[model samples]
Target chain A: MNDFEYLEPATVAEACAMLKRYGGEARPYAGGAYLSIVMKQGLIRPKALVNIKKIQELKGIRFDPSEGFVIGALATHRELETSQLIREKLPILCAVEREVANIRVRNVGTVGGNLASGEPLTDLAQVFLALDARVAISGPSGDRTIPLEELFVDLYQTSLGEEEILTRVIVPPPPPATGIEYIRFSSSSVVDKPCVGVAVRISLNADRKTCGTVRIALGCVAPRPMRAQGAEALLTGHPLSPQLVEQAAAAAAEECSPISDLRGSERFKRGIVRVLVRRAMAVAYDRASHASTLRLRSGQAGSA
Target chain B: MKKQIRLRVNGMDRTVEVAPRTSLLEAVRDQLGLTGAKLGCDMQVCGACTLLLDGKPVSACSFLAVDADGSELTTIEGLAAGDRLHPLQEAFMDCGALQCGYCTSGFILTAKALLDEQPRPSEEQIKDYLGGNFCRCGCYQEIIQAVKKVAGI
Candidate 1:
């Protein structure tokens, strides 16, 4: 790694001031997982590294059924995977969290770093985009919330300014009688590279047999994680029959524009997305129905 | 561009001055003369330089020595209690988990952290935790058994 000045700021205001002073010459350091590797590869040559790991405000996970979930930028994958609130309110996030790197990397890799890097293969991007999560940024201009879809501009690019720091990610709780699932396909038996990843969030009707609303997001098959609007339109307010599920999956596949890479061909990735989307939808529907049944049973017991 | 860094290793504090870019792996082996943590990849990919930073295992190669100032560090040397071996060390020896022993220290430390956190983890969980720590000797079956033995499950 090239020689660079290291600055440890005690507060976010100081950090923002440092960034404003140095501009592109200074980069905020979160977990240092991707940034350190990039530095070693000589991809970037920042004049200074502003270590933000010690900033207390950017750490920890908090959630409420009414208020949604707030994940601090510096919250490591290990913290998210084991967070009781995240597991209870957004279990799909935990499911995807388990597949990221490994225990050691998870301990050091922060959600901010992963999203800031803007890697297409990252799991969080798809889940967040599907759930319509918001990215919170802080800078000299103060804080602002950007919708997840607006955050990603292209591969390895984001809407964040050079002096801006991502502070937190806000994940809204699923609507009542809703379920979510995340599924992905890797190159080998081990998850080295994700060929395709699909995240689905669906709200079921009172009978728990029909879909009232649905959202499908695809990753690893596009320049950025995107919602399968065509497929979502096919399922909303419709009963989830096997025929309809297949049609929705095919629509999702047709909508994706994947590039052929070392991991797999574009055609293969599209096919995987189609299959994974169907599987994710099935799983999500099952979970939603079960949750609805349990709610009804508990309500009946209370009344008696 | 050298700075003075104080590291508390194995319950003993040692202060040393080194170049700014010196990694924790080099400081442990070269400066402190504690060579138990071997340098395999000199990158975070290989877990040969794994050590405990505040009770959590991290790759020493990617960690700067200066970042460890006033931090509690536990290396492979700290595993043994004088004449007695740590439970994981004894279990590894009894289960024949090491062949070349080049990756022994890192594997032991990683396992120590896992066992400490979850005393009775299942086989799958043990494998998942050890995923970052690689073993080229293909003795992973024995290593898993060793961890399981020490975990008493």
Candidate 2:
């Protein structure tokens, strides 16, 4: 934690200017939840921190009739956990966010900072990937929107440029009869980072008997959260049967590349991935089947 | 690189000049002389540095002191009125929710925020909210009792 200039920019344009001027010597300071720890360990020492907390444009979670959820990058995890709009459209996110890190971290950690940090042991990317989330970035060249998966490059790395600032996370509303579920496996304490996280989204056709579009996203099993394309290929446009689900789950277990760490062993992680993907897929399918009736009421959604 | 920031700490207006890297815990303890919030793990894992920022519990150890500018900060010292103890404090005392006391401030601050947000939270909710604060002495049973007693549940 070395001394550095703290610059607070009230607008995105100003923030981008400051970042461009500082070049690689500046970093956008968000909630400081993850950045503080890494900086304290001397992993990063930016000459100036472009504090983006005051930027009004990056601060709200709004719903667009056509585009669905336009979540501001500065929206804290606690805000998402308690947002009425999010609870209405994507209750699964609320449920998953309830178990993210802890109350303290959730109160200040922003969704944008979480994704921009490119930390692999996260739950949001997998869940967002299942929902087909995208991010908006502003830089010297201008603003551009890209899929969230593309933003992630490798360990603590993002495809974003040095001056690019991630501004918003856009999650299009789930299609009708679409159900998404994300399950996290913590090897030790509930507070521990996920050993393996599995997110499954299943959209059923009008018949409600077959999967129309399916997505399987796995986290903490690779350098970055990734889609289990092979596993997803097995279930898309097909009926989700016991045997089919088993095959897809097995394929997912074989697809992920996990290394041994304090959380769990590689084999154990794959085993957890298999179990979580299977369970999450089954849950998602059940919800998609009963999407209309099974949707949590606003009252129940507000509880967690 | 030191910058002056204003904070309404413990319901009192105060200002401190801190470097960008100075943590909220250090500022509160060293400059403000309110040391209820302790630096336990330094990482955000342990809640020993929990402080209520605008009534929301934040890890002061990881939160930048300068970022708390123009915000209301409540620590363990804020929970009492003169010599009178807050209800949660009384509940903790009556229920014997603490032993070594290293983790007491953090737990109490987090519990205060929880009770403030949800006056009557379920048992599961209590565990979920307080799950981050670790107690080596294992006074979890009494801690739950204290919170429930305060909630009158």
Candidate 3:
């Protein structure tokens, strides 16, 4: 890696000031998994590295019933995997975190770093996008919140301002009677990046006869993780049947533009997306319906 | 630019001056003369450079040495008690688990972390725990046996 000045800021304000002072010459260092590799390969040469891991504002995981789950930017993948609260409230996240890039990388790789890197194959961003999460940013002007979907501008690019630092991620609680699932297709156990990933969030109607809301997001198939809005729109307010699910899956496949890479060819990834979308939607629907039925049973018991 | 940082390695507190981009693996091997951790992939894929940072196994090759400031680090050199070999090391030796010996330190440290967290991990748990470490010798079954023997599972 090229030589650079290492700067550790104790607070968010201090970090922002360093970033503003260094401007483009400084990069915020988070997990350092990606940064170290790129720097070693001479891909990026920064004059200084502003280490944000020490900032006091960017730490901890808290869940509020009204406000939802607030995950500190520096929380590692291992923390999310073993968190009892995350397991209880959002089991899907735990499932994905447990399988991210083996144990060592997950031990230090932070969620905010993953999002900030804007790597298209990242698993958390897709899951967070499906959950309708929002990112909190702090800069000279102050703090602002933006939907997670708007954070990624392109491959390895983010919409974050030059002096802004990603502080935390706010994930709203899933709607009542909702089921969330994220599935990735990788060639081997050792391969961390997925060729294609699909995340589905489905909320069933009161009677479990129609879909109230559906979110289908695809990862690694394009320059950025994107929501399959066409597929989602097709399912909303419509009774989910075998034929309807097939149509939605087809639409999702059509919406994505995948490129051939080391994981697989363009055609193979598109095919994988179609199959995963169908399976994910079906599983999500089954879970949402089951949860709705259980809630109805408990409501009747409470009244009785 | 060079930065001075203090790190506790193998129960000994030592200060080292390193460049801004120096990795923990490089500092331990080149500066401190603790050559237990090998530099394999350096991209965080191979776990040959695994080290215990605050009790969690992380790729020292990718982890910046400057980040080790005020942190407790455990390398393969820290596993044994004086002359006595650590249980994992003894198990590997008795079972003849290592053929090439290049990946031994990484596997031993990783397995130590696993057994510390879970006393009697099942075979599947063992495989999942050490999945990141690559054994170029292809003696995986023997390695598995050694870990299971150490865990008494």
Candidate 4:
């Protein structure tokens, strides 16, 4: 690692000033999990690091029934894994957080860092995309909100400008009878990056006989995490069954463009995605059915 | 580019001067002369550099020493109470849970944090918590027994 000036800004405005002054040489320091490793490997050398971990605006998890769930970017993976709010509202994300790298990494790696680093093997952003999550970004001009899907641009890259910082993520509440699940297949240890990751969000209509809306997002199979639109289209407004799930899974597998890496071969990745999509859909559908039952019982109790 | 960092290590307050690029592991071992936390892998893969920062296990080899300012740090050397070993340490010794001893300190520190957070962790929880620490000599069963013995599980 090279020697560089370390600056700690107490507020977001101050941090923005420092970043603007330093221009391309300064980097916002979140949880240094990824940046430190890359720097140690001699991949990137920033002349200055503006530590924004102290900024209060970027640190918490809150959930509202009407407004949905809001997560401060500085919230560590450990925080997400243990947060009751996250567990109640977005249990799928909690499951994914529990499996990130290991406990040591989870203790320090922030959600913002995970998304901003633009690592392809990550599970959070993929799941966020499925849930129609939005990110609140702050920059020199002001703040702007964008869907989480659009934030990702390419391999190790994001749509964020050089000066913009992702401060928070807002996930809209799951529609009535909606169920979500994230599943992945790693070639080696559980802590290793996934060869194929799939996230599915499905909501059944009032009759519980057909799909209302469905989303399928794939990760670690492309340059950036992407939605399997072709697969999702197959399930939308159609009755979900074993046959339908198989067809949808095949479509998702074909939608991915994976390259052969150390994790697994390209063909193996497609196969894993196909299998994961099917399993994920089954779990999501079952959960959605339960959710509908719960809603029905609650409504009846209120009426009585 | 040298900066003064003030932090508490093993219940003692100290100030050290380090270069901007110095990692917490380097500062602890080189500047402060506390070499208990070994630098097994510069990367965060192996937990040989595990240290409890504010009661949370972190990889010191990759953590910036200056970032730990105002934080309480505990290394393996902090486990003993003057010549008396901590319960976890005693258990490891009785169970012979070490081979080369290179990964012992890291594993012990990680296990200490785990037991503190969950006094009676299940075997699965124990395995998950200490999964970050790697035992190159393959004393995993012994390590699990040592932790279970300390937890009375």
Instruction: List DockQ, one per candidate, in order.
Output: 0.54, 0.90, 0.80, 0.81
* Accuracy of chain B in candidate 4 (TM-score): 0.98
Q: After superposition, how far is residue A129 of candidate 1 from its true place, in Å?
A: 1.8
* Model 4 stretches astray by more than 4 angstroms: A64-66, A293-304
Model 2, residue A123: distance off in Å is 0.6
Residue pairs whose backbone atoms clash in candidate 4:
none
lDDT of 1 by residue, B1-153 (tens): 778988889999899886655778889999999999988876577689998998998888877776777888999999899989999999999999999998899999999999889989999899888887778998899999999999988
lDDT of 3 by residue, B8-94 (tens): 988999999998788999999999999989999889887889999988899999999998889999998998999999989999999
Distance from true position, residue A283, model 3, in Å? Answer: 0.8
Better of 1 and 2 by DockQ: 2
- Model 1 local distance difference test score: 0.82
Clashing pairs in 1: none
A173: Cα error in model 2, Å: 1.4
Ranking by TM-score: 2, 4, 3, 1
DockQ-sorted candidate list, best first: 2, 4, 3, 1
What's the lDDT for residue B126 in model 2? 98
Candidate 3 per-residue lDDT over residues A29-64, each given as its tens digit: 988977898899999999899999987778888886
- Order candidates by lDDT, high to low: 2, 4, 3, 1
lDDT of each candidate versus the true structure:
0.82, 0.89, 0.86, 0.87
Error of 4 at B26 (Å): 0.4
Counting clashing residue pairs in each candidate, in order, gives 0, 0, 0, 0
Please report the TM-score between candidate 3 and the true structure. 0.96
Please list the residue runs of candidate 3 whose C-alpha ends up more than 4 Å from where it truly belongs after superposition.
A292-304
The weakest ten consecutive residues by lDDT in model 1 chain A span A295-304
iRMS, all models: 1.8, 0.8, 1.0, 0.9
